[model samples]
Target: MASNPPAPEAPFVPSQRSTEPFGSGSYRTDEGPWEEWNPTEESLRPVRGRHRVAKQRGGLARSSTVLGVGVIAAVSAGGMASANTGKPPVSISMPDLPSVGSLLSDDSADAAEAPTAPLSGIGVTSADTAQGTTDAGEALRTRIMAQAEQQQDQVDTKAAAASAAAAQKAVADAAAKAEKEAEAKAAAAKKKADEAAAQKAEAARLAELAKQYTLPTSSYTITSTFGQAGSMWSSGYHTGLDFAAPTGTLIKAIHSGTVTEAGWAGSYGYRTILTLDDGTELWFCHQSSISVSVGQKVATGDVIGRVGATGNVTGPHLHLEVHPGGSADGIDPMAWLQGKGLTP
Candidate 1:
């Protein structure tokens, strides 16, 4: 009976999850916040399309940049190798890259239509392969630069040599020209001096001849010349020239001679024959007085006799005759005197 009475009215115990609402004093509302939740991939599908293309473009640009870096590293390595080997670098040609326009284009349809081959298929591959290509390119650049520098040096050397040669040639030419001018001047001066000397010598010779010779008389007129046509002499023609002058007029020796004869002849009165150095004889006939004796030497212009009317003369005159080689026949005295530079 007591146990039946114990279970009576067991205390009003609340359930594990209370169904009653909190009190207003705790600052709660009937519409409380829900539990925190995490979203899944499917639940975020609405925003995927907006950013997908941008992501793809960014990835392409990053890949291209990485390829460029690899190439640069390879080039640096090759340059170092050539410097150590002391050999010329190799040459490399790079393929054309995509332009900015092609890279920035967003037309997927166009990209699909073009359908270019991958980098590996077109002879470019991993980072190692790019490095090797870049190394070859660097070697080529080094070779080109070296060749250019060598060519420039050679050109400069040649220019310098040519300039030096030209200068030397100019100097030589100028020296040669100066020498030739000096020689020509000397020759001209010498020739002029020689000509002046010759002229002076000829003048002196003429003066000497004038001093050594004189006329037979001071003032006389030629009346008859040698070879004149007439019977005035024993021969067929006049054999001596007649110089008409006043009686006692002085007669002189024409040139230096020795008196060979000073005696009278049948047709000559007080005649004198003078023999010269060349065996030529000069005869002075019909003289008033004979001062020079036989075998006497007389100089030119010496008073030998005087003019008078003697044999072979018509009046007070002197007959003169010139014989070459002491011959009988006489030549014209006027012509013979002119041959000795005398204007008789």
Candidate 2:
């Protein structure tokens, strides 16, 4: 603008930085950016021989700290690993090695010292680490085994309790079943006894009823009986009882009843029927004489007829027949008489 700003005054230029080293008596500057520097004869002269010696000492100090710390760490790691795995430690060699106790001693001056001897001179054995690891491993194994035993004992106790409960339940069930069976047996026995007692009571009642009746005739020979096979009668088998006697022998009533029938019954000859109150008819057949009339009442042992050789008679005898409800077929007269308490 104004004559091109008077030909821009020459750009500001700074002096070149000099990299010459300081005097030997001066402290060095190591914190700054590096620059190419040239040493002076005065600065190099003082450190020429002693410098290498100091560096060697420093390296030894560093190695002692590293080796001491590494050995402790390796030992500790090996012991822990061995204890966990239940195995021996891996072999690691340390030359001219002192005891760990001495190396780790609280004295700072002693820990600063390094092993001065060569690698093949002395060392710690692998057996030392193995011994320590074995002791720790055994302790751990004992603890584990103890815990396992305790758990097994607990399981056994629980199992025993359960078994006892099961046994008790089985016993109770068996007892209940037995009790039910016993009750059933008792009921069956009681039922059988009651049935027997009822039968005995019925027999006693029938026996007392027998005492009230008597036989129809006496002092006569039993020539024939009911159900006897004979061609002398018309009905295949004898249907009445025959008491043989002389003609005009007396016949009597077996029980007290009215005379519902008293007349000649054809093949029955002269017959007299005495019907008891219970509708049982007593027939006196082949009679020589009839002494009772129809509608006449009679008593037990009353004479109703006499023995004679009447119609259908093989001999002079009294034929007695029993007809329940006045039906044609009659039962055995001898059994009927016995049932009526007479043993003819």
Candidate 3:
């Protein structure tokens, strides 16, 4: 028991670590994994040649990204490494962290550290500071006044819009009413014009009737002429034209006139006298019967008496005579008939 079985065989120990950081946490190394010693600069040269540290980022975007992140980190980190000699193998702290204002120029530091001005338009006041709040009180008053004015302006704008709309509606309605009135006036004028035209046409028709008239007893051929030498005339010449016809031949007025006499005359015998508006008188002598009475309104072609062989007529004939006034006077009956549109 004291001999302990001649000391069991010792377990094998692994070789010591090399000097490379990947192998033994050191930067200088030349041996394989089994080497247990550090290396000098000459011995580590080959390992240094075998690997490389990249000089710059690959693309511009990558470079920019790296540069931006590095710059931001360095500015904010506020500490620098004190030694690069690889002694102690750890980073050492620098004493001073430069303030952003001290590290940059006055312009850059002001741009970076300056508090932004407040947004302007509605709440701005004349003063820029607010230590005692005197300016702040005035600014608050101004803002409240501006807000009230804005509310009043909104109400005024709505009222103006309503008024304008009402005015436009009224104008449109007035235009429509005026158009309707114009149409009605045009229609009325057209109707009145049509009536005037009809009245004119009727007057023209009556005038045409008066233009074409003659004594009905005339056969257009005078059997005896007035002023011709004849025994039947009381003034030594024929006092009237003799138009021979049947005893009951119809008689007609020479023109538009009024009957002045329709009774027996001393010499004319069953006579009717017509007086024209121009004061000219016409006598129908030796009428078998009178068809129109005295004072009767007679137009052209109206019957006044009949043809008969009475008075001084020797046979069935009409004794027609003219009287300038009412006295028995003689005139050419043919010429007088032509004046009344009677064509012989």
Best by lDDT: 2
330: Cα error in model 2, Å: 3.1
Give the per-residue Cα lDDT of candidate 2 at 23. Answer: 42
Candidate 1 lDDT, 146-232, residue by residue in tens? 999999999999999999999999999999999999999999999999999987886787678778887788677878887888876
Stretches of model 1 off by over 4 angstroms after superposition: 1-204
Q: After superposition, how far is residue 108 of candidate 3 from its true place, in Å?
A: 99
Candidate 3 per-residue lDDT, tens place, 1-344, comes to 47556877654244545344643556555423331333334544332221111222234466556556755665434222112222222222221321222222245434454333322222223453453266678889999999999999999999999999999999999999999999999999999999999878856764574475665655535678767885666778877777888888899888888998899887678988889887888888888999998789998888887888667657877887877666555577767765554544
Model 3 quality (TM-score): 0.38
lDDT of each: 0.72, 0.72, 0.65
Model 2: per-residue lDDT, tens digit, 35-114?
32333445443422211001123355665676678878888877775545424455663323323333334444543553
lDDT of 3 at 18: 32
TM-score against truth, every candidate: 0.41, 0.46, 0.38
Q: In model 3, where do residues sit more than 4 Å from their true spots?
A: 1-212, 218-221, 325-328
